[model samples]
Target: MRLETEMKMLQAKSQAGIVKEETVGNASRFIDVSAKHTKLPHFQDGKDDLDIWLTRFERFAESNSWSRDKWSSSLCALLTGRALGCFWRLSSEQAQDYDKVKLALMNRYDLTEDGYRRMFRS
Candidate 1:
């Protein structure tokens, strides 16, 4: 009965244009409704370099003309393993800020300013 009422409320919200409705292609699957859907390359730890991946993502975002406000959410979709975990560890507000999130990811992977300097020196 409670679930039914919640479903009805959700349906009403969808009808009223308060919530966007997403089409399901197959069996019902979870989707991150808050994110604006876009295809982005996933970040893999160990196998891939974070700095290179970040550069590629920035170029891709610029090429697509994606707004800075949408970058954090869109980028969240592609995070995995330690990177995803790094994102999760941030406070909700920090998670919404792309620069903060990026810094957190870089720090987690030992890509700090000193680390970059070491790389350059090497």
Candidate 2:
């Protein structure tokens, strides 16, 4: 299977909520295997850590034409509120904190600072 397809499948499994032990085991296996092969530096360098993932995601948003306010809000709602924080590894509190930080960064930079944008861009 393609890497993107594999990643999507794993992400879906992770979002499906905790099930039987066997199911959890399978999801864990998929994540472990994917992490081992992914080319993303954050994943390869043992920095696929939650914070790093958030940083990378923010950077991706900044590079686009979308306004920082919209991007940050949407990301906080999508990633932290629904996907990663809700379905993946981070706890609710952690997710909330991440959203706060992302929003703060957006506000601080007025959405124009190259350094701020670069921090999360890629």
lDDT of 1 by residue, 13-118 (tens): 7665455556688533233333554666689878889989998898888876667877889888998999999999999999999999999999999899898899
Clashing residue pairs in candidate 2, if any? 59-120, 59-121
Using all chains and alpha carbons, the TM-scores for the candidates as numbered come to 0.64, 0.27
Q: Which pairs of residues collide in model 1?
A: none
Per-residue alpha-carbon lDDT of candidate 2 for residues 23-56, written as tens digits (9 for 90 to 100): 5644544333323332323222222344456577
**Candidate 1 overall lDDT versus native:** 0.81
lDDT (CA) for every model shown? 0.81, 0.46
**Positional deviation of 115 in candidate 1, in angstroms?**
1.6
N/CA/C clash count, model 1: 0
Top lDDT hit: 1
